[model samples]
Target: MASLPQALPEQRAVGPVTRPAPPPIARVRRRRRPSGEPPPLPRQLRASGKWWLGLSAAVLLACVAVVATDTIRYVDVADTRVLQAIAGIRSPGLTAVADAAGMLAAAAVLHVIWLTDLVLLAVFRRWRHLLVWLGVGLLVINVGAAMATTLQRPRPFEVQVLGDWSGFAMPSLPVTVLAALLVSTLYSLVPPGRMRTIGKWLVCGLLVVTAASRLYLAQDHPTGVLAGIVLGVATPLAAFRLLTPNAAHPVRYTRSRPAHLDVSGERGAAIVRALQDQLGLVATDVAPFGLAGSGGSTPLKITVKAAGPQDDGGSCVFGKLYAATHVRSDRWYKLGRTLLYGRLEDEKPFSTVRRLVQYEDYVLRVFCDGGLPVPQPLGIVEITPEREYLLVTEFIAGAQEAGEAEIDDAVIDQGLAVVRRMWEIGMAHRDIKPANLLVRNGTLYLIDSAFAEVRPSPWRQAVDLANMMLVLALRTDAERVYRRARRHFSDEEIAEAFAATRGLTIPSQLRRMLRQQGRGLQDEFLALLPFRLPPVRIQRWTWRRGGLTVVTLAAATLAGYVSVGLLRSPL
Candidate 1:
């Protein structure tokens, strides 16, 4: 090859020596449109998108402020006793506990967002949708605080609260904040599917514990806590609607069979549009279920039978819808205030919905797994995006008539068996009743375990029994029911167990109240609070069934009491 001749500077300049061929002309590919299809609208052009972005940003900013402000004021006056006790016993341990709890909360929040975004992006592969949810969660905490403060709500502490406390009373800030975090986290992390059903129950249980912890610790009032949950959950959900895909046509179901679709991953608005479009096939003639009871706790059952070719009426699946009403103030909105008093949402006592849904789910699942008779738990479903309605498993065959007739001798026996089984496993069906103990195919099946306290002590165990007796008393003559229950044991034995487990007698006032119904039940239950108070649990221990020590803790004491009472009673 001939040696390359050196090019003169002039020649090189002429040939564009310093420059190169213009960057390759890039081509943008346009998505091909199907014939007759309308042109796709830009995502940002939708009105809902604007609202979604705005609402989500507002919620996120609020949450950050609440967390930061609360974190800065680290004193929790309500838990002084518990804290002092722990610190006195183990200095390092107390410090570690405090540090760990704070770390855990922070980690949990971050992890929730991360996992939420990961799942949403992975499933839908949409960045914008993920952003909307992240924003909604971030805003929920601070919004909860602002609302709580605006309301001038008070914490449940009987003594002086530690920090700058100010808020209206209604929705609880702590409970609501927890609810917001949990709902948003679950909504983001888990896709609505077979697995989601279990996850939802677990999450519900977790939230209940959180709320109860707050109440038990005397951090916030029950009403305030519940209010917090409402605000925390509702705000994000409303924002989610704004972020819906079809801005003009949000997801809505009225007298229509809900269609199962991939509503997970996308912004709330998108999910709404998808639901509306997919479930449009449902007949408008079918009347949907409505909300029932105070606090919007009770769910209405909706049965859909197939009338068309696709309909096989005999094999139709039943759906339940839990409805929600707007409350003025909610608990989760005042999270910062509650936390200042050493209150965490999970510590509060279980709510009606909490019992119906969370405890019911756990009881059913655990009993079912233990080979006990239970209604088939098809799974819990969300009727709306708002996290208000929760559907539990309803029996498909042979609906029984409602009334005192529902509580017959056979039903009572079954209830005893069920309670006995629970007791044997070191569990207490805290709210045992004729309604909760359903009769199916002549077999008595336990239904609601909402307040069931598993692995309870003698006191807790007795109170659980007392609650059952109380319920039984409502349906039948108290003396007669007491006599019949004595057949399994003696009156004295029952009383002893009752005393040992619950620590006191049912007040005459409460007894008279039970006869009145409704408010009576509420008052009676509340009155029994002194006896059934959840003990100040210093420690919690989990043990295997086979462990001897566990067996001793679970059964020995209760068994000894029952055995001694039986021996003392006359035949």
Candidate 2:
């Protein structure tokens, strides 16, 4: 029930006279309220908690009252016929399946799954989901066991037990434990799409089968099973609605699925299909490579490579889609960077995805021709009128991050070589983070050149070297990295580098990481290079351009009007 993302209105202007479109009114988010009041509790929890609390209390009271008054018989009316129907439908095959399901629903299985889930959630830092799981498990076990003993309800069968049955069976503990764990685990961890849907249906089928087995095996009455299911489902559902992560976040790991024969699973299926047609090859699978999102703009991934005719895509290619909205944001972000860094983010007219795509393609061509290790840009594909453009490039499979590899002199040489090669061609990669540099089969490869340019600005070049220094220092000792870098660069060059990157901005998390690792990469670089670079002109539309022209016109017009008024006064 989100209230945002209202659709654009369809109305149009009637008059011939037209006006320039208005700039978007900025929505100023107040970080703190003027009243300095704590945020109000959500109605979801307040109202639902009251209702659930009352219902749970009433149910408990009713259970106790029924036990005390010996009115449990009234609720057991359907137990006899339900048991009869279940027992009559039994067969060897059905019995075998029931036995397997009974084992699956056993308390031991639930315990193991719960432990595994906790380990996973802990790794993901999904603390809220873990809390929900722990709370629900505790309630179901203690409360269900207490009800069973207090009610003193008998097993449906009088014969010697075919399997281990615990205590009285007023509320089936097995059903309660299994269903609660399955539902909560699935709901909390599953992402949106077909995978989630299939998981839900599969869990539901298992629940139905397990519930029937309880009745057929004469382990509990239908009422007991029904009670277990109600408590199990209701508790987890209510808890998780209030507990799951409230925001999208980046995970520490990436998961790759085995490409299926069809591309239906992919969100960019239409774009994939078009690529398939263009290549004249059947695309058996698609792997989405969206930059794990929310905190930053994400790039889309389209690859039918896995399930292609070969082990890899028949063609050695991968695809990226830049959505229109992201393009608009890039324009503003590039402008901000230009102001702060005094470097051109992109050519004039603003940073559109189309413009970036073209720039990237041209840059990649330059690298390919110059014998640099970079991905070959294939072509560009347009997917929509809103500027959803796709860039195709050669795939470099199983590339390792620089941080993951050994940070010895050899690795340092590879990094230096890449930067020095770019410098030879008067090029600079403004962003030289650990993620952007990759190593494959002992060779370093550079990817994500969307922010690169052929500008040979001294400061910009120095930023690349300084950023690399910071990145490598995190992996190894500062002195070792510095000594290795000295072999490739002189003291003066190193000094200029640190000087050039005086105002570099890095991601907050990365900054904290460098701090925790016993050294400041940038500080160390600055300490080595005491001198700064001289002023150099960079292409940008400053106030000196548009603003200066407008100001001059206004001044001239004012002077002319004043002169005319003086002449009239004299007359």
Candidate 3:
């Protein structure tokens, strides 16, 4: 072997094998711009400026009028007769006239704004704007009344036989009108900016000037004028911001659900059969899961099946039946046909729950149209006047009710993302407890819209957000849980939500028991610490600005505070 190596086998020269270069990438062709098309305008700039201009002009006119009137008040030369006449006009008679004039003027302006809003809605099909306008009008009325009560500034000195005068003197009617007009006018004309700095400044300045002019004109005292402006200014701003842009508020319940009698001698079995037949539910084949709830309440059975005929006789789909006995004064067996065909909610008046379900049905449809992930509603059927209500829906298989501990950090992260999407769409769950939130095959699903209201009250929205926070807080750090919620909601909103659920009952007694144990827990925690920041520290940190996330988290914190207190307690 060594001798052969020494001979050095003629080294086979290896040539560098060359591969052909990849074919030149096909060039991406640039899309040609459409011929002669103008660039699109920014939405903010496209908003009409006419209202702003008109408001500016009106303010100038009012200023001029005030100055001219003041000059007249001081410069008039008066003999005894002239003085007497001037005094007569300035007396209660003239005061009454001026007051009436102010009211009439306010009414006229309000009517004009209303008509303009209606016309705009009709032409541009912007109902949201119309709602804003209506809300503004309501706020103005409230402010005006409050101003009159707060400021008792009196009229100019005058004497008249049988004269009549009333209302506060400081903020002159003209000045109040000017302030309201400017605010409302600007709101109507200006488009919403991400920050709205210019509009905010404009409103602030208008209020200041209106108050100053009224005092200078001697129509109202400085205090009265200031009070009126303050009142007026506060309302519109609070209402405008609180209303939430583009929120579609459903009609409030005007009347209670009517209590109708059960149909005479209706049998529970017969009604169930009739409904099954009508809805084409094959109740005979499937095994049903039965549950008995609070007494005088219904017994529910969940049954699964497929819709159409199957050769193999195996179906994966299911339906739920809610049946309850309807009791009369005589304690007769008039099987209550009242059945909840759909999901349930936290403790609520039955009537309210029904309304909520109806609203949710419509809202879910809306969400579907808008491309949001929501459970598809098949249909709802009422079985009887007093016995049962049934809802047919796509049963999410392998879905599990989220438990307190199971809904940990990961679940919360995913759930909050869904929450953000809901807020962006101007919607809230109105009920965010674990029961309503489902995890099916590892995907979080929002269910149980029986208490769902589209664009609910601020309190309601907060409660909904808090409910979710409570769910997360049960298994996670309170601080971190709230921080996550604030990424979508504000502190004030959170506080409000907590306030709403103050007296509400939880579905689980364990939760209630923990809450009961946690009374004065915040104080106890404070006492235990050597030093402590304010309880609202989390709120301040999260929602000091109007950030959506902050507001959302604020809600969550309140929920978390309550939830964690319950969870950590020695049960």
Candidate 4:
């Protein structure tokens, strides 16, 4: 039995207890950039003004204005004087040097360089960069031709035309083509750094020599050479800077995957600052993790500083860095799928990086609320509002991939149960490969839910179940896993699952694994089922599909025509 206790006496305050003022709320200053504004320029482009496009347009307008007005007389006089001065110094040796330079800057030599660049870009799979290069070259050629015809300025008449020439020479076509070729090749091939810096100076020197040679040979006016340089360098430089930014389409000779963004240098520092300011999570170190298994977004392991004193140094969180490149890749991927399978599911692409990250984060929260074994969503941190984002989540430490782990009865059940839960919740983990499944402490975890869908198609859900079962059977016997699955799903459901499962439905990683095994794993699983159902037809054509197909074919044909024209163009 317990006894009641007595009351205690009260004591007076020793002194007025002082309370320290709360620490000033730390305020983080964010860049006041508008959402529609482009991403911060890469380091190589930082020194240039943001209005380069406008500036180039202004220069072009000025050139046109000078040609249209009487001011052209003064410019022509200056041009003639400069050509005469160059002609005065012409000697046999000088003439020989000028001829050699003319040969070097000839249209044929420039076209060869252009062809080599195209081949290299294709071999390296730099498709975006390749497109920009082609577009710039075509634009320069067309614009230079039009401008030359409009101005109708003849070759310099102050001296003898020592070199072979043709057509009006307001903007020297050779000089323009040479400038465009050099600029495009440098930006498309050389990685941005000290090497590119040296390349820039060398390119400038070559351009100067070519322009001087043309002037010495009395082939082009000074103003014509100047206009050519301006148009050639400005147009492509602006286009490449805007379209294939170094941050997204960096030129590198290494074998690193393009999907994996470099997390060192400025991007790394930006990540740390963004996490601290936006998410209130102080990240210490950020490094890529499991790059070999990811192809969509760069996976990173972020070490976070602990908030409390009792914490053990720090803990790590997982992050997926999504950029403009990923957004483009997603669009191309969906377009390919739609063209191939005719809209199997909701194959719409996200409009922006923000939307992409938002959808994934929302899906993660939904799965977490529904009691699925997915990573807990830690809010998104925007590195660049619409251009780039980072989706952070709980890092499943000490977990081995399903393919590498010991898949026992419990592991198999948990894996099957995940699909059951997803089905019950009206959700489907569209990607259910061995790489996305993890086993730790006898519990299976599902990750990489970026492709998970809500209220997914019945076929899609069936495919999910089939994929999970196939993954489980990879380690254990098909009959044993089927027997365990029977407890959660019915025989008819299993049959439908296998029926929905096809070559395309399987994730790429799973398909590769199946091929490597050289065993009929999918067929074995199908045999264990009570009965087989007819394979679902995935291809269903529609007006949209037909239109898209036509457009794709037309675009391909245009691209081929442009390629051939580029190789054979008479600059």
Candidate 5:
């Protein structure tokens, strides 16, 4: 009762401050997303090595200025103290060894190393690696020597010189040359792994020891050594960035038989030169495959002397060349597909030639790793920025169509088994036609893997089964193909397969062959094999749907505002 005077303020019903509660509407705000196109790459990403180069270059210039002006003369004392400290630990044996190691990384030895590396690279035909090696050498040795000579800074005075040397002190020619040579050589030659990591640490240790040796021998100042190290690391990396963009090969093909190619044309000649210059390939001859499709990529067959590492100096391989016109077409088609229609063809979203080639190369390797039969992917080559790209692969010759080969039960069984294997591997060959299936030396090889996809859904896998069965139908009876397929497919799966082919794109060549063999292939497949239609997904909300929703909400909001204005109007 005493607490009545101290009762809850909220429960005081007759309080003057009483207020009504807000209406509990179940609406949530929809935040407007930014425009679909991605923002530009960051400055660091766009410039890459150039940013590091600029920073290192600025530091180098500042060090040179400091040494020239003697603005911080006491800082130079640290340089002298570093030398004295290193010399204090120096023994005759360690000095001799360091001196010898220094001599090994000398200009003469470096030049010899460069020449020898180039010759061996020429032997293995590691042209890109050779280019990087040469570029590093020139950037480190020649340009560094010139910079040192121009700076013309003097060596430390009143310091005990353990070894003899003559040079400016701004950038230690020894440090710059040795660091760049070691880093660049390792970068180009060593594959990324534990070995590469070990190589980096070893190089780093050597560089530090070498820098310490220069200090101990009273060869250069600390600032000079620091400048040399920065220059050495940055210059070679910048050169490497410029030299290699697309790897050793950059082409991919969609079809085995192309209707048009000009290997002797201007673009073809440029392609040959690019391969020769970048990859060190001696092209004995180049021939066009006359690939079909107006802008689709095709492979050019090339006979080369030392085209690959395992070459006996001469071998034949397939090369796909993509010039400026074709690259743009690919870009436009992919952009349109993604932004407008939002569909991918054969699971490969359209991209540049270099990237697409890389994807296929990776896919081919995966298939090979899993023991699937496919052409061995050789390498990729980029001639111009986005204009010219080329991809090389092992050329399998003397292969004919399934239609040309004997259409026995074994052939049918093998073909169906392959489709099953593809499905087992979660792969789908979107372009499974008789022409793409080759019979070579009594073995079936699946070719034109450009449209191949992995990890397909059951619906997509069913579509592939239908396509494979259709291709086999070209050589023999549709019923015969159905019997072989039924072993792998259930009734529901088979029904879904038939239903999936409603609007599948068929090549004109395969379409003609199917019509010639019999009537409508779809009808024949349905009549020959018993099947039922499977449920399909209706497309959910798209950009259009969301856009319409937003528009309706905005329109209602506007109408309410107008009504409020009319209510407020003077009459």
Candidate 6:
């Protein structure tokens, strides 16, 4: 009786009381703007080229004004005094040292240094930096010659010239070329940071030695040496800073793949901010992930903080970073493919980083909507407007590549079912290699949809099926995979799949894996089939391909000729 106390009137209810469920957390979806309409770049990210150029211009104008006005006499007098002082202290040893320093600025020495830089840059595939270096060198030489010709000032008066000299003495060409060469070499080869900082001071020290030696030998006036130093260092430093910024084209000595962008330091901080502001994700960490398997773009694993109570702590997401280098790589890749295998169904390169990211995001959404077992499509985050972008998606946790995971019958069926679903939806993942397919708790997940094509050709779809089967068969025997595949695909379809697949059709990764298997798995699968078809001809000739072939050969020949001429030209 005591345990069954009557309910108070205030707490009584006509029926079972039900509290309203908490409102679902509202997620804000960022509306993607057209690529052409990206927000204006922030002022801080704008290149500092204009400022450096202005400073150089001011120096040039000051020198010209001084020489053009009555101030020329004062500069000449000062130059004479400096040379006289240098001569007054000259000894046999100091004079010999000055002669050696003059030789350091010799054209042959500069040529050797320039050629070495070219070779190193070419070897490292730093084509952009190499081009910048060459262009800046030409500009500095031409500009220095023009300025010296315009001034046409004579060597120091009443000072005996002791070293070899050439050209007008107002702005010494040797000193200018030496300064430009040393500065450009440092920027082109040395990475930006403490090392570059130290390299800069070393370059300055060398420039001082050359300038002072020129003054010591009375080969050029002090004003001429100063002008040469200013012009030589400023033009290239500004141009390189403007054209080949460290943010886009980092200089590294590692032989690793060039497509991977450094995901640490300033870039990492930028990524965290972009994710939080643009994609509404509080990213705590961003690091390179699966870089060994990826070649086209940098892969990153980003860890984000939980948003609300429903979230199960923090979660990891996958990101693919695309930049201008990747864009160029895509162009080169497509061009090579066209030249080698003739227009294999839409081999056109993406026009920009934005378009490349947008295409992948669209394909991901389409696949997800079509009920594919792909990663959930997260929004794209802009890292540097049109120059760089990051495509985000859900990370399939605890997943191993299909080749590494133990493939049971269920895994085999799931792999086949992925292709079946793609066929039903008129989609083809042009890259169906082992690295792109992930297995998690027996579920197969397809990734790297950048190459996936919607409404693809039948040949392309067939190639996809073949690639997937080869991947699955690598884990199990071909017979088991074939038997499991038949439940999802017809025998004729499977035959067509193999028929459409050739060496060129298979991705490089899958091709290499098949070679390693070495058991003739492809031939075994062909034997199990009731009927056979000839291997599809992948090399289709086209006028465009022929024209590209001709142009490419011509360009290569011209480049070789130029390189040889540079190497053989007189010092």
Candidate achieving the largest lDDT: 4
- Looking at model 4, residue 68 earns an lDDT score of 69
Per-model TM-score versus the true fold: 0.36, 0.46, 0.35, 0.90, 0.46, 0.86
Candidate 4, clashing residue pairs?
Answer: none
- What TM-score would candidate 5 get against the native? 0.46
Best-first order by lDDT: 4, 6, 5, 2, 1, 3
- Which wins on lDDT, candidate 3 or candidate 6? 6
Residue-level lDDT of model 1, residues 106-181, one tens digit each, is 3345455445555655565433345555566556655555665554534534343322223543345445555665
Error of 1 at 166 (Å): 29
What candidate 3 gets wrong by more than 4 Å, as runs, is: 1-276, 285-304, 307-360, 363-374, 385-387, 425-428, 490-501, 505-510, 513-571
Give the Cα error of residue 503 in candidate 1, in Å: 14
Q: How close to the true structure is residue 482 of candidate 4, measured as C-alpha lDDT? A: 80
The candidate 5 region of ten consecutive residues with least summed lDDT is: 14-23
Candidate 3 residue-wise lDDT, 243-277, digit = tens: 42211111111231111212222333433354354
Q: lDDT per model, in order? A: 0.43, 0.60, 0.43, 0.82, 0.62, 0.80
Candidate 4 segments whose C-alpha is farther than 4 A from its true place: 1-45, 49-58
Off by over 4 Å in 6: 1-51, 60-81, 150-157, 308-313, 561-571
lDDT of 4 by residue, 373-463 (tens): 7777878887866788999988888889888888999888788778877877899888999889988777788899888888988999999
What is the per-residue lDDT of model 6 for residues 1-571, given as tens digits with 9 covering 90 to 100? 0112223433311221122222222234544546665342221424445665676788788767975784777878988998998899988899999999878788789788878999999988899888788778767777887777777777788888888887787678888888888888888899889999999899988888888888889999987887787788788888777677786678888877878888887788888877876887778899999987899999999888765667665678889999888988889988988898785653778999999999999999988787777887778888887788899888887889988998999778777878878887789999998899888777777889988998888889999889899999998898888877777777778899999988778888887888887878888889878788887788888888999999999998986776665545332
Better of 2 and 4 by TM-score: 4
Residue 274 accuracy (lDDT) in model 2: 49
